[model samples]
Target: MMASAGDMDTGSVLLAEKVTALSDPAAYPEFTAAVTAVETHFSWVFLTDGFAYKLKKPLRTEDMDFTSLAGRTRNCEREVYLNRRLAPDVYLGVVDLMATEDGRLRLFGSGRVVDRLVRMRRLAEDDCLEIRLKRGLVASEDVARLARGLAGFLTSQPPLGPVSPVGLRHEINTSLLDLAVACDGCFEQAVRRVTARLLAFLEYRSDMPGRDRLVDGHGDLRPEHVFLGPPLRIIDCLEFSDALRRRDPVDELAALGMECERLGGAWIGPVLLEAYGKAAGVFPPAGLCAFYRGLRALVRARIAVRHLMEEPIRAPERWPRQAAEYLRLADRAAAELTVPSGRRPSSSAAL
Candidate 1:
């Protein structure tokens, strides 16, 4: 039972309200003094209808953290700068928060330096890709268009010089490790099987070719972060650190594929890969797609676990259920790797 678009939108609005309440004047003065309103979630997002102010929360997670004011501000600035690379029309600039003589909060930088916000042009909620996906409004053509668009972006960008193979290995392993810790006993056997598959993949590919062509990518590439319009827009990149953002493009593609499968659209994996390959002149490495797909599942599992741990009371009891969904996908992906035909294609395979 997947949540409907309407339900998800309602949830987002509720989350917005919760975020506002949590960051209200009485809750945290520094954040309150910096923005007029907060939109809450992952980070405290403040907005004025016309513009958005994103303030990183001083929270830490296995994947990311904005523990200090300076760290938050740095990440905020990075968000604006990096997002502009893909979405120039949106992502205006960083707004600074300034304190008045009377001790009132105000937006600065464009005027005076008081506090900081990652200012961006506000987009309509209805236009969000996540909303569209939930509503069954995202057509195959839309997915094709998005794939072509992303492929073009990757092709035009220069490769991020040789990423350490060890680093890539660590990225996949760390995600599985975190998932194992998070799941504990709920799905011990499933988690263990997935972990073994991940380790095997890493071990088998330790000496694969073309490891130097990896590039900086959207660590969190999903429908929610994409905006569908005349031209599709990918936003909300993992700006907390470059380590996560820099990786094999296949890993990014795998993240999208796993999400699509989870959302009941397994066909999208091959569709997107075919489209991307047409634009980039190459598909993901042989035998690696399944591995990355498993890794993506593991990452989602970690996120589900994090939600359960961080917001036990607020977190849905359905989290373990959702985590199970990802685990199932991981198993499927791992199984695909064992098939003789799975490793046959180098660049002509559909997915």
Candidate 2:
């Protein structure tokens, strides 16, 4: 389902509209585009009244690359396909530009192909789980509902194949190596300790039974990507590569737990885990909670480091503080794994 630049229309109609939207309109004189746009930690999303168009920047990271128009188109198509699994009602379709008789860019062609766009039905921003939580609209019942919904989704899908186990490990190792390189001397020891623990855990579990129980999962299941609506809808998957989404179910839960904790809902992790486990008819391996907690922390640390690495020019004034927080989380995760009982107070118990 990967999209390519050739899929869009070469006509100037749609192209003109999109070109005008960018802050630097003059940069693209070929198309008469106009729209208000905003940048995120990852993509440059342009907003129109009725629809939203996402354009992947020419960015590269440890796990992904959107360096070419072709790559971006493919990723955008992947985004539409994968997100539809959870949010079928919201993900409309891919939008493309077509060429007109005079070499003008239009939307989908009555003519020739131009640039590709992922067109989506716009949802109210306030409906996002992150926003709802910030507005004090989220409740414990809502968390429980989300847990049940995700549990149902995970249980219904088949487990990942054996090939995925090796792939997942490689991704974890790669991310850890990147983190180790980016961390300062003060934080390197902590990062190394946690990374080592995770590596050990991966080694021990690689041969464990039930490899098929793992499946392709939402690689970045943060609150921000979840929409709190009639039904919980997860969106914006890691579409650039398969390595990001292919993981253990517990790993997915752990990521969500870490996000909940960071958002001041310390108890939600255990509550959600308990609910999901009950629904799935199994408990995660004993020490895995600890292992994935450490893994999640390290993942977040790596992400923060990647952000700093990718765009040092726009580094937030709080970049140092953010880095420090990630390091602290890594230290805490390492300590948690080494404890006699891996099940310490919930990772988010104090929020």
Top candidate on lDDT is 1
Instruction: Give stretches of model 1 more than 4 Å off.
Output: 1-42, 60-67, 108-114, 162-165, 181-184, 205-209, 309-318, 339-351
* Model 1 TM-score, 2 decimals: 0.77
- For candidate 1, the per-residue lDDT at 109 reads 19
RMSD of each: 9.0, 7.0
Model 2 spans with C-alpha error above 4 angstroms: 1-35, 59-70, 98-112, 162-176, 181-183, 200-210, 316-319, 338-351
Clash totals, every prediction:
7, 37
In terms of lDDT, the poorest run of 10 residues in model 1 is: 1-10
lDDT of 2: 0.64
Per-residue lDDT of 258-288 in model 2, one digit per residue for the tens?
Answer: 7766676657678878888887787776466
Please, what is the TM-score per model?
A: 0.77, 0.77
**What are the lDDT scores of the predictions, listed in order?**
0.66, 0.64
- The stretch of ten residues in a row with the least summed lDDT in candidate 2 is 1-10
